[model samples]
Target: MPINCKKQTLPTIEKEQIDLLARLSNASGVSGDEAEVRKIIREEITPFADSVETDVMGNLIAQKNAKGKCALHVLIAAHMDEVGFMLVDKDSEGIYRFSLIGGIDERSLAGKQVLIGKDHLPGVIGACPVHLSTKEERECILKLESLRIDAGPGCTDLQLGSYAVFATRFQAFGPSLIGKALDNRLGVATLIELLKHCPEHIHLTAAFTVQEEIGARGAAAVAYNHKPDLAFILDSTPAMDQPSYDNAENTQYRTRLGFGPAIYAMDSNTLYDHRMVEFLKTTATENGIPYQIRQPGGGGTDAGAVHLSQDGIPTATISVPGRYAHTAVMIARKSDWENTLRLLTASLDSVSQDIFKNER
Candidate 1:
């Protein structure tokens, strides 16, 4: 029998894309401590980008030259940091307790694994075993105070000020890609893909922001400095597909996994520019790119800061719909990622005057 091997042409967006995204997502770069993620972005994005620089706040700004040199600037933003905890105190016995750097749903963090410090020490957030807990305890709301990261040999290897971050674990289940830090790492990955394919005529500044989970600090600084005429924020939005007590308006928010990217209209802090929103939708539809309208919105992106900066830039957001956001198991669909790349590339390639003029 002849040994047979088939020649396989990999996908246009190959496993390398997902693998790179996963590596960046898994790397610990909590809010203000983004050196590692920034290094990765600098290395991969610098070659394709025209000019790159770091602002006072450590936000990474990458630019590509465009044919139209009319000083009309377009800025696109995607936050690079994720919600995690900082070391609050360490007990003499080596038990480490921390406070959240951003909004972390305590319920989801009960038994998750985490990383600590520059070396990324492996640790697990401890929880009472089901067998050890009483019926009443099981029904009670879990508190962050009860959580302790098990770093082992607490007195020797662990210190009082060591930070902890969710372990980066990307898993594919059915239609979803579940992992930690997808909230903003997905945005960074989308920007990288955009840079790889961005045409020469699209003159824009891309800012991979920092400290967005705590407050939109990085976005505010970069937007004020650049004063872009138009800005687009790429991010991950919540996927409300699970069964819950609130079902009446819940169906309106069914941004499902694998559906496509989301055209975010409004959130708690920002209302998008109407023309920018319409343009993104129309362009995506005409280009046959998959997309969905985000119904019953609830989260904020860098669009909030970018729209309010300088003389006020017209802004809108496009996000990958994700399940279990702000948790160790945030899940996003590959189709959503692909659609975001398509919509962003199309939007940038054919940016119009009307897109920047819309104030609403």
Candidate 2:
């Protein structure tokens, strides 16, 4: 049966939200080093939440308790970490050998600018110049061992384990947003906005998780700690919507920009709980919010970890399709982001204990 209820007044994406996204996208919170991003989130959500706590694993959990007794507990998570590099060994005055902190493509590293340490000291991933390389050497793919971070000749401030990220500054390009770390920062911003406008009917637990780029370490810990009735993981999925070399329909394009939120059916990790999936789809349809079923395939989100925690917690993922995720820069449409927020808000507004009554 279709839900018959008053129309939900969805929250609009505003300059404040965009500004917060820019700050999050620009911040360097690679995998295990998410303090800066956590700090920003702590400040933003403090006033709006009923209680806020940072757990042992650096996951920031903020709760908004429902006024009535026995309200459904809903957990929403967005990772606060991004793919980056960590300095390992200093080879020269300003040259350092760094290892990848997450699943960054090695092919994209050479000649890219990076920011190192808490000071964000500028550096570049240096490689042999094309002019200097032999044809045979150029034919082979560049390896991490062959690359070095060139901070500067006089720079000696970098530590052995300092983290670094791409130096891509946030920018609004027409209707799209381009920046580094947009993968999860977009989700982070969305979660913050959701917290601000969270409905009072359910107990909402918003988790800003860390170390997700490496694995779902923070999310696993968060799940065990909070153990909500169900979970929603907000993330950014890759949009392989680019034209193919032969332009033969490009059917494998996982997700696309401007298509609105991509709701997960299945992925590499968890088969999304059918009840949650149906609930989201029904909410989007009834609310007239645009959405796409994310091409079920490789890739996973925080839900991968959350669903397996406790006896079982139903989980589903909703993502904003982005192009070139885990690279120096990624692009996602502003309208898609707005619709994602709308869908999530409407879903939260409509969710109740009855959703669980349906057989999974």
Candidate 3:
């Protein structure tokens, strides 16, 4: 007998998820450098998850027993990598030259705190002083080369190969969260929350993917191997509620803070499965769970890689709305976090053919 969405028990996210998110946000994970973050995930997931494993590319794959039901493959993915800096060179005087691992606004690079090496050595990115710049120089865009990292007095002590991650730690701001790496750390934390109450018969696979900041490389491999009947990417979508950007015009979607989870209809990577999109939105509405759909054309998630794998799997993405993404201080709404857990758990519990039928 298939589980009915109406009859499914909704699971609530606890304070543990928030704590984990804060820890992950503070941890160092700059694209290829995710060993420490992976270790943290492994520890948390080892007990509750049925079979914990890692893919060739360092993707943490955790499996749960599924009563052996065919077409019951449900893969939920969240990238563990975050945008940060990587060493490019070192000057004769020992100042470090670096490049960004993920997309970062050049304007935000000036005077930002960062972590370098296994010792978590502190450093600050320095840009030319505004007073020193000429009118033409000030008008010019801040190029990546213009930024330099200051590891403080004894610069020779640091090596050229060390990595640099955003140093801003997580903070609770009003009803929203402000911290670094909330972009995907929030997504990872959501998956962790789901693991605690996940039903034994659900037959689900959750992956803490890597290198999503560079590309959707980690999710691509996992999807090809599992080839699940359905897949969902839990991630963070950038919010345009700030003053600089026009939330309605340039932005394709506008999901406010505390407004439940953002359900993406389309992104650069993949067109969401129509049935899955409708089911999730309708399910949330019927269940009184707050939710919103991404506009016609908008940002993408790991679902892009998962849906296009092997024979082409159906996929959808649920995101937590975040402000100042890619920057050190990212923010997520409290309600958005709670609502994502409710939505995903409900979808897992509600699995009838009628709900998935193309005709209905």
Candidate 4:
């Protein structure tokens, strides 16, 4: 029986989903240091998976076989790591000098609270006193050169080279969900839901990857190892959906809130598999689920690595629109995430060998 939207009821995300998202948002999974988040994922998914394995690169690979003879092997991925800082040095006064683990706006550095090291010790990025800064300093955006994390006076428990991340906890306000690490944690949460309800036609392989912010390192390895018939890189893409300065027209919003999922035709790293793109759009339209085409240009996701794993695996990215990615906190709509999961689930349920028979 092929999976279709007519007989199947779309899963509604509510408190349980939000609660898992809260746990993921609060966990620390900085690039090259993903232990905390990995632990939580293992606990949540072990029961649902037919087999679970971990690799040297620290990606958690879980498998679920189809109920009958599988027509295709489907690989779905969501990155576990988030952008943060690594302490490079500790000053005599216990101030920590750190380097960013991934792309970040230096402007968000000053006066932000951070949790440093595996112990999750509290710290703050200190700024020069407002009364002391000259006008020239005030006029320009602060750079990484002018920042230091003050763990507090005489605190020496944290070692050099430890990871640091924003101390922001998860919160849901009205129509918006806000938290740190939402960039891919939202993806993480979405993948978890999909795992629980594996479709019957295709054998499902889930990749909970690490080091994505650093360069899609884990994704490349997982794709090579599994080599699915096709792959879907599930992630959170930056919406940048805010209004222009002075309320002027903002034409370049990569995505916008309430637009549902953003399906990638092309991103900086890869041109998505054309047939897969059409399949996703067709499924969404048939189900009356809303979706958007991600503007093609800058930024990328795990698809950058997965699509080129071998001779080449057909890959597409389906992302939830998020605002303020790579910063301390990000916001996204639960409604958008709902449609993302629904649309992807429908497509995967309906997938067949025929989709790949079309042109590249």
- lDDT per residue for candidate 3 within 270-350, as digits (tens), equals 877788888898778877898877555656778878888988888889999898899878888877888888888777777
Model 2 scores what on Cα lDDT?
Answer: 0.91
Compute the lDDT of residue 171 as modeled in candidate 3.
83
Ranking by TM-score: 2, 4, 3, 1
Q: Which numbered prediction scores highest in lDDT against the true structure?
A: 2
Error of 4 at 198 (Å): 0.2
Which parts of model 3 have CA positions greater than 4 angstroms off? 1-9, 68-71, 243-253, 352-354
In model 1, how large is the Cα lDDT of residue 122? 83
Per-residue lDDT of 291-349 in model 1, one digit per residue for the tens? 88887456687888888888888888888999888887787888788778777777776
Candidate 4 lDDT by residue in tens digits, 91-161:
76778788999999999888899998888899999898999989997999988877899998889678888
Collision count for each candidate, in order: 1, 0, 0, 0
Off by over 4 Å in 1: 1-12, 129-132, 243-250, 356-360
Badly placed stretches (over 4 Å) of model 4 are: 1-8
Q: List the residue pairs that clash in candidate 3.
A: none
lDDT-best of 1 and 4? 4
Q: Between candidates 1 and 2, which one is better according to TM-score?
A: 2
